[model samples]
Target: MATSTLLLHPVRLRIVQSMLGHAQTTTRELAERLGDVAPATLYRHVAALVDGGVIEVVSETRVRGASERSLRLNLSRASVDPDDEALVDDERVRAGFLAYLASLASAFDDYLAAPRSTLEADLVGFRQVAVFATDDEWREVAATIRDALLPLIERSERPEGARRRILGTVSLPVD
Candidate 1:
């Protein structure tokens, strides 16, 4: 399967998102985190990702009589490179982008559906920013973001009262 195809799937995208910032995650843990997805379906998507090289099984151990696997995402394979001619099928890529947006919408809807959702108190936010900058300026801004966020990304300890939040970034030129 194409990387874009594998990565942009709604369920698969959620699986990837759950694995982000962690060095490794177990199949059991994924099953628990994405409880809405059936174990069979989740296992299928995980196998597909493993086959596509989007994720790798780093270790395996037996829990009871069953085999348990520890997996990690290959971040390099988690996105589409439009410049890579071999991977660019215009329609597929566009569809994948739409699926990506749909996943974000679904996440927000889930949040709203939660009984105790308090957007302001929860610090939930989504917005669009339009920037006019030369390529170098844009690179600098991106670099700044990376530098500032990298530490948090690398932290393995979950401090008290620090709830997990998802952050998504999209940049596109205005035509």
Candidate 2:
């Protein structure tokens, strides 16, 4: 499978997201966290990720007559290669973007299904702003956003008083 195809499937994407900011974890642990997904389905996607070299098994142990593997993303291969992106045609790019939108919608649905009071107390937000900027200005804005978020992304694994949050950004030229 192409790296983007392997990584962008909804289930696999969620699996990768769950692993992003943490130490190595076993498939059993992942299954527990993603309770909505069937164990077999989760295992199948995980196997595809491992086969595609996006994730690696860091360790293995015998557990109740089965081998449990602790896996983590191979950071080097976890993202689509820039060279590969250059080779992708426009249709592929649209498909990839659609997949991303679907995942975003699914996440929002899950959040809304949670307790109303809890959702209200959380810092969740969505907004859109139309910006008129030259290419250079747009690049500067992108860099500024990245700089502001990099520290928080890097510190995501902190154990104390830390909550997991999903941050999504999409920039597209207006027609």
* Candidate lDDT (C-alpha), each: 0.83, 0.81
lDDT for model 2, please: 0.81
Candidate 1 ranges beyond 4 A from true positions: 115-117
lDDT per residue, candidate 1, 5-123, as tens digits? Answer: 78767788888887887789999999987888999999999999999999999999999999999999888887766665545577766766777787677677778888764778889
lDDT of 1 at 167: 79
TM-score of each model, in listed order: 0.81, 0.80
Residue-level lDDT of model 2, residues 1-175, one tens digit each, is 8888787577887788777766578899899867888989999999999999988999999999999999988767777764775436777667666767777787788778876566547888889999889989999999999899878766636778776688878887997
Error of 2 at 38 (Å): 4.1
Alpha-carbon error at 142 in model 1, in Å?
1.8
For model 1, the run of ten residues with the poorest summed lDDT: 80-89
The total of clashing pairs for model 2 equals 0
